[model samples]
Target: MKLRSLLFVPGDRPERFPKAVATGADALILDLEDSVVPERKPEARAAVRAWIEAPREDGPAVFVRVNPIDSDEVAADLEALAGLSLDGVVLPKAEGAESVAMLLDRLPGDYLVLPVASETPAAVFQLGTFAGVAGRLAGVTWGAEDLPASIGAATAREDDGSYTDPYRVVRALTLFGAHAAGVPAIETVFPDFRNLDALAAYAARGQRDGFTGMLAIHPTQVSVINDAFTPSEAEIAHAKAVIAAFDANPGAGALQLDGKMIDAPHLKSARRLLALVG
Candidate 1:
């Protein structure tokens, strides 16, 4: 469960399933939603179930993205996966906490849930309520394509290829909502797998903004995303130093460390970083 990166693999590509586990990602998402078309839904669902049933050399947490509850395909998907040993279901276009609760009613109690809030305008506003759902709510992510369309925007991306301002707003909202709900705020993927540098930069930015991790479209991007999210040697050292300084001077409310003022808040941040590294 020490997830730093969750890599997605097309459900129909059973050949690539083992390769995905070998990527050293924290989790693998066998996608049955966007990646699988109408014609291939049945095959994709079977392929994911088969992969889950088989023995595996790698033990990365296994997840599957089922079609949304509102979709016609969901009934069949749930019936097919009613009692399998699934780590979770990635609910696309979650309407709100109520929607999540409804899905939970259908799903078994043991299965974890992660909802994508970028599907519709109503979902964007109800990001705060996802935490109230029971079970292991993994985190919240947004879909750029769905949100812009919901708002009737011409494009989710700007001319510079960055998310438009409204999408940025939703991203921030999702981040805060996840944090408030006591779950990780997972950043969405950058679809352009060809541009490693840009992907790295964007992942690094997400890390800076307090997102715990990110999703990956391609397995090749796994290393970059994991590296960006993981605490570096220097960072760990600094965090340890901050914790030590505060621990050694318990009575003092504020003190100077390395020419900078150290306080309780800074010490807490340092400890959180160390926890991540651990």
Candidate 2:
């Protein structure tokens, strides 16, 4: 599935579920963890279940963000997911391959797993280990909020709202790890959904840095996120031209394209873009 924009909806708020799906998000993550209060857990799970089982035509792929693996509520969340036709679950506070495996062991079908890889301090070191379970991962993402609280940091970002140096390293690790696992590198939420200008720049930065998609916190940010990740007409044209150039000159190591040096890596990147869009 194309994941250029994945929006999160509070699981307890069933009223917003259809609205979220109608927002043109590539996927919907029905959140049952941070979004739901303890008292509303049962209500949220039932709502998520009903929505997934409801009759529907075409809509976004649905993913449920279950509570932390070690939490008491996780079992109930798993039970709610049983027999449901859904895309996957977003495992939060995910530590390593073991956590992913534990979730998989319970899920009966071939459900894809998208783990929020870096939440706790210990999760940072285990990011590389996710390659062990790459076959089932939809993508790997990281969280900046819980990490800061875990380490007692004032903030995960700087005065300019950019991630601090530590979080930058964490983000880089998650990006590289996702690539190593042969899955899309999904950027985390931008948070300031109303700041279209800043959100556009943020999503652009992620796309430029090789992230295939980004998480969206609000419906309004979906289009901006999708636009950022999608290749422009000129980009598609350039990619096609590069493919043609390489195909035209078989075995040629280097080629001239628009008076610039284009070689093996360029050809690989061009193929990647076309493969993604195609």
* TM-score of each prediction: 0.96, 0.99
After TM-score superposition, what is the CA distance of residue 246 in candidate 2 from its true location, in Å? 0.8
Q: What's model 2's lDDT at 59? A: 88
Off by over 4 Å in 1: none
Question: lDDT of all predictions, in order shown?
Answer: 0.86, 0.93
* Tens digit of per-residue lDDT, candidate 1, span 1-278: 56689998988889999898888899999988989889998998898888788776647888889888898999888877877887888899898788778788887758878898768998888988876773468877777887777678898888777887888899999999888887888999898999999999999999999998999999889999999999999989988998888788878888888899988888888988888877
Q: Top lDDT: which candidate number?
A: 2
Error of 2 at 49 (Å): 0.3
Q: 95 in model 2: Cα distance from truth in Å?
A: 1.0
Model 1 earns a TM-score of: 0.96
- Model 1: residue 120 alpha-carbon error in angstroms: 0.6
Per-residue lDDT tens digits for candidate 2, residues 1-278, read 88899999999999999899889999999999998999999999999999899899888989999998889999999999998999989999999888999999987788999999999998999898888999989999989999999989999998888999999999999999999988999999987778999999999999999999999999999999999999999999999999999999999999999999999999999998987797
What local lDDT does model 1 show for residue 85? Answer: 86
